[model samples]
Target: MPSFLGSLRQFVLAPKLSAVTFAERGFPGAGSAAAERLEAIPQAVVCGFEWGIAARDLWEVERRLELVEQEQRGFAYEGAAMAFTVRDAMAGGRGTRTRDLLLGPAAPHLLLAYIGIGFAMARLPRPLWRNIMPDLTGTLFYPTMTWLAVDGYGFDLAYFHPEKYIGKQRVPPPYPWEGRPDYFPRAVDQGIGRALWFTGGAEPETVTASVARFPSERRPDLWSGVGLAATFAGGASADGLARVRDAAGEHWPQLGLGAVFAISARVMAGHVPEHSALACEVLAGSSVDDAVAIAGRTGASPADADDTMPLYEQWRNRIRAELGAISGEQRKAS
Candidate 1:
């Protein structure tokens, strides 16, 4: 049974935090405020991550999580994971539970669980993160905290669902009806991009070094991950983005593609992170309006695995086209 505060949190604050229009109305000191909140997220993620590491076993971890939730304060930055981390933290290190929640029929629950893992990652030392993830499926589809990027993207979409989809008051469920199993890798790619944003902190070199720890194939994913983070989290300077792109070598295109997605997502959401607009211009030679136009056409629906893949591809293609167009313009200008 859920605790009283936990139930109230899910039914009340979580929905509000996930609401489409919550962040649209910027507050005074909104930039600083957003940064502060973003910082807190990693703190929560690490706190939960550390607990998982110290636990004797899965049972112990879940028990400690529940105790912590009993005293959890209301929504931190209104992030879905912030309010619901405990629910997902309970499933940490349990392969069966993780699989059932993420890939099984109840996959809507996957977002919370992945975010919980981010929380777990936050607590674990940077070195241990590569080895400690719970292998839900037989394969490691989401290396590091890449899976959470799917949730990060989904949460933003769901938050704006009512406004974007019209008459959709409730945030859309995390799972689409036409679920695409193949989409997992792509989703993980997005998550890795998001992880880059968090892990990079104030330094692009930190991001580069962090990506270096992963296998070479993951380099593209890591570069793109940083791009996504810069788009939403908004701290990368032009010089910094350039350094990252140069460091990417063959993977530069992937990094640019990741930036396109992040920029588009932010535009469609009606909120661009501070400096993200500049980052977009510097990295993509594109404006937020371009992103809004491309992202606006996409819609959300519940679908099965078979149906979701094509849609994701279409979205990818749309962003790629925009990217190609921008590259052409930059070349012509030069």
Candidate 2:
């Protein structure tokens, strides 16, 4: 049997399994290729962090994030542009089967979950900081990473399976319903742009205003959520915010704060079906008290810990069993 620590390590180091599918399916175009590779980086980072925390080794998460950040910063501007083109192309059609082929059994559910979480997080009230902090920290990271996938690396629509859209090809379908169009593609891009904008040293208000004007179905919700989060966090430094805004505006001004929140929520909630099993296990085993404790340790306020504990315990046991089964299969194969 794998020790908890060993299992955690495996989870963290879980190779870019999704990328293998991308390569196998031959989704042509440089942007498509880049998107495929970029998608893996965040997954690897998140899985590593999740596993490390499970094993009580928090430093690993920091290390992984640092590595990811370095890589993201190093990607060239031209490369990022190519990625965007590919993403847009994929969004139009062409690679639907490629997306399906790569995603296999786990793609649909995972996509829906991400969409749900993103919308949910974006719509959250600003005053609910205590309730939303965990969701913010835990969920936001993934969507933030997705933004990087687009803006930083230029990943395109093929990465998201745009062929699933219904009607005029303008909007993504609603959750659990596969035919709807994605309503917030522009919003997602805008959120990414804003993050880059704020990181660049623009005034927060300027960046905030620019984000407000960017189009999105969830614009009001996203603006409110980001505004609240920024306010609560005391806001980023003016110079820093400007730097981010400058960079984002240069690449994808359409990406906005609300999309970022929504993406993060999706990532945290493990709405992605491929990741659901692991997400469920983590949530089940994790204590609201512990999450609150970790938040306090990180200089954040303590949040309500009463409601999620029972659910956490139940999921943890369920995950333990599932993990055991997977481990057994690995051993047999070996």
Candidate 3:
């Protein structure tokens, strides 16, 4: 007994765009344009908010790590407790239903957030719920929405895994096998096979490639906006903030605006104060080397090293350096 408005919400939120168009096209002003496109694209509007939450969580985790490392006393237990809470919440449910509901209508939105922002965040690899919750919530949300749309509203989109339909359908035997003992059963299997067949040379390749290409293994640029967002959302230490700022500055100068947007969104979401000057400080100046130096000094401790120094930072740095080198060559030629 789903309501019409509920059905409409779910349908409008599903992902539905070609890979070539969404990923490879590289539209001018991709950040702002992409944000607008995402807003307009049905389900994508919620992505920024999800990513903001992730950034905040990661920032909190890093902050706790820094505190445990530095204080080694009363704060250590608190830090551990905080970290455990994030893990537990992620493992169980931290507004998962709400997130699913928000993203239910948009398939591409979920995909893009998972492959693009989620992968970039590296929250998918860890066992902690904080890392895995977004993906799991997204997975459930999309399928449920699809089920509702098809079963309740009579839409014709195919399911992600068609195997679930095997026992639901009955079919006649094929060819001369009609009289054979196994013919009827075999025909049913054949129907299932037909349903599962992919006539196209390959399933549309988007998320897999994006995930594969993720720069999780490298050092991130300090200036990338995700880092900035993480900082303003609170729970990050001064040192963590410095690392994020440095990483963004060193690696993702172009993404500075996006970082600002992320911070703004966090404030708007009520996760942080509305007018924090930290956002402005982090976004100011061309001090990549200085920021990197600060991060090296502050974030070089054992705990920071253990967690791999923020996946977002690693990715931003790697992408920025490569892009910078390419831009350098172009500038040299000019």
Candidate 4:
């Protein structure tokens, strides 16, 4: 049974599973298989969150998540991670539940789980934000990769209020995350880019068109988000992914960088879905191992960088440039 606060959180925050359907969200291609898959992603997150918020023990959360299918189990973990983060934050920093979840069973799903922290960031107050994340300092992707939570916060804003953020292209004021206020909006834009994937029902052209509507300065990050979604959530086929890559044109490197990141996350999670495999081939033009290796070889510690362009951006630029060179070689060969 869920704790009282957990139930309250669920009642107030968790959406009805049916409510996330593409049709309900006013997304295109409501009845398509792609839409169905994309819709299920949010539903899984909600279910995990509901369970995590209410559970009396970590074992309770773990047991419930095990019931989810293997493919979506990571999403469930993501949800639980979000729940724990929110609960811990609300607790005023006395709990280690979020820490335990990530360092323990949830480590493999660290990518999504970290994004889950962003979900907490959205729901909690800014002051409480400090408590939302545990001490993940020495871990892989620590500190720097927490940029993903900013991404997640961006995704939540756009997803929950598309008309305001997505349709209107409203830019949220920047927060001094990771001691870098200037880069905050860019990270959020990347999340918005990810949201565009779902909002467009994974249609390459539709997603690309929506991206074009943004200011040219913003399109590169938007394209990067699109590439991550195309590679990870995958509502399209190989041809569709190819369309996204070509549509990216000058920002193709950003798109491929997103793909490389997606592949790295999936590989790290230890389950590469068939669709992800295809997206990697189409966008990154490489096998899963190579894509993951590319990400691995690109950057390491977030130990150094200027505030305007942090180590995180450095990592992304390196991946983007490497992908660009590879594509250049491919084009020359063809």
Candidate 5:
């Protein structure tokens, strides 16, 4: 009976704990993977935290992460951010990291780290948090990351500061590429679209309503962000995915395609957290196998999943060519 109990214990704990290895990647003595792996640390920590909370048996999951929190604290800003994310997740976003750092001094990469905090926020009961955005003084990826925060934390644009958007109607500072007339507003929409996917709990109408507010030309980019959120963290059902896919319209294939790539990249890194896997499974269905084939077709294997972004860009270019058109091109030509 004791042996059987021990086996049952292992079965219950192993999958949840497995993600910890990914979470631990960037700490000291975690080796070369640490340096190359920092970009993925936020995802790892949040996923690990979420899995632990949602585990079959949650008796000691939070307690087990205490040491991880301490270990993550010892690293630099990213490490600190990861530590804070884990601690906040364990504490259900009531954790003090935001009061200590988010509302105060934070490195630029730390802003990226805050995105992880938002991930934890998405998983917590909505009653636990209200208006978590802090005074973000510097101009980094603040616009993009703020949306990430809103989505992960379940906040509305009303909760976002009005002062930040008071400037001229030009694009926001953190344009992913170059200057565009409405680029900033579009990015904001993308962020809001992402938030809507989370804020509406991944409902198709939420994404649709948010996208409708944007100009028709800008909807696809906004939907791209929506697709990402829906697939990466939405926890949508089959009907939900079908609704999302249908709502995506001309963007559906690309959205589903991107979902596959996102999952495949995680798989390449050897960290198939259940949330991401479920996302891919629901979005791509049988196309997931196709995505795996496409990911490998380039004959390039990134040492880390974070390394796959550029490769994905390359793949996107190839896909666009195969589709016989360019994405986001009509506006540029105009």
Candidate 6:
């Protein structure tokens, strides 16, 4: 992917750093520090995408990505993986760019890298999506984390085409992701929920209100997305996360489920930023260790009984049920 042409491609195809700013995108933000912090997330994505597209080798990309701050480094890998996926797709599925990324330098952050593939999915047509996710036969969370790519596509749609997906609340048609068209929209909503956290500028009132504008049934998935983004991305303070959690009310369990998933990803990355720890304590109502434990305890296996639901949905449902039970226990103790 390294060359003058590749650099030109990145320059032409990727968004400018300025373009990702909240104000540039017309997303709500008071220009507060938190808002600025939130805005940097996408900018990091741009940086990663550029580097990935232009680097001579995975080692070069990996070395360059190390220069990114720890908290945002995974995001750079995310961006790089995105570029890699696009390259692979463009090469008519012959390039090993994306597969090498996941199995090599981007391995630790496989979770975010999966989402990066989804971002590429949004850009490439349905036909090119065939071989995007590399075959990670014995990996810890291959097929499961692949769902995050669908989540990424949802985020991409809502992020770039707010008027259609977010404002008008259009339901995008389903793809048979992992052979489940019925669950595709639900997975996409999870990503849209994540985008809402950013679209509303990490402001609790605006984020929740945006979710509310969507139909009632959709709000739960949306809230969980909010929970995941608001936690993992960390634009809000402790107080702000608490407000986001409290705002969920009946949807609190869904929100907590999202937070738990975020925590699990962070933990797997082998680093937990201060904001994530705070989010776990506040939104997830547990320390990082406990949240990870809850996620692990409720984790579903492909062998889990009942052939009705996909393991991915079953995994989420299990987490929500655990969070719900924990919430119930607290209610009684209080």
Per-residue CA lDDT of candidate 6, range 170-244, in tens? 998888888888889998999999999988998888998898888998998999899899889988888888888
- Residue lDDT tens for model 3, 1-334: 2246433533443223332122323322233432233212212222222222333343442343333221111112222222222333444545343233224322222312222222211222223322332434324322211111111000011112222232233222222211233322322232222112111111112211221232442212112323333323232334444554454344444334323333433333333342224533443322333333323332222233233323223333443344455446767999
Clashes of 1: 21
Badly placed stretches (over 4 Å) of model 2 are 1-21, 30-54, 67-69, 73-162, 165-334
Ranking by TM-score: 6, 4, 1, 5, 2, 3
- In TM-score terms, candidate 3 sits at 0.24
Q: What is the Cα-based lDDT of residue 75 in candidate 4?
A: 83
TM-score of each: 0.50, 0.27, 0.24, 0.96, 0.43, 0.96
**Where does candidate 4 have its weakest 10-residue lDDT segment?**
300-309
- lDDT agreement with native, every candidate: 0.47, 0.30, 0.29, 0.87, 0.44, 0.87
* lDDT value, residue 114 of candidate 4: 86
Candidate 1 lDDT over 1-334, as tens digits, reads 4445544544533323222121332212224543454454434433444443333344544454444332121111112232233334444433343333244321323324554444433333434333333455442223322345343443333222323311232222233212344555445444554555543453668667766766676456556666766665565667887787777766665666666666664543345565778777666656777655655554222241243254555555556566666677878999
lDDT of 2 by residue, 80-107 (tens): 1222222223334232322321133212
Range of the 10 consecutive residues with the lowest summed lDDT in candidate 2: 149-158
Query: Listing every candidate in turn, what is its Cα RMSD in Å to the true structure after a full C-alpha superposition?
Result: 14.3, 20.1, 23.2, 1.4, 15.7, 1.4
Q: Residue-wise lDDT of candidate 5 within 7-87, one digit each (tens)?
A: 453454323433323224221223233222332333345444343333333223333333443223211233334335445
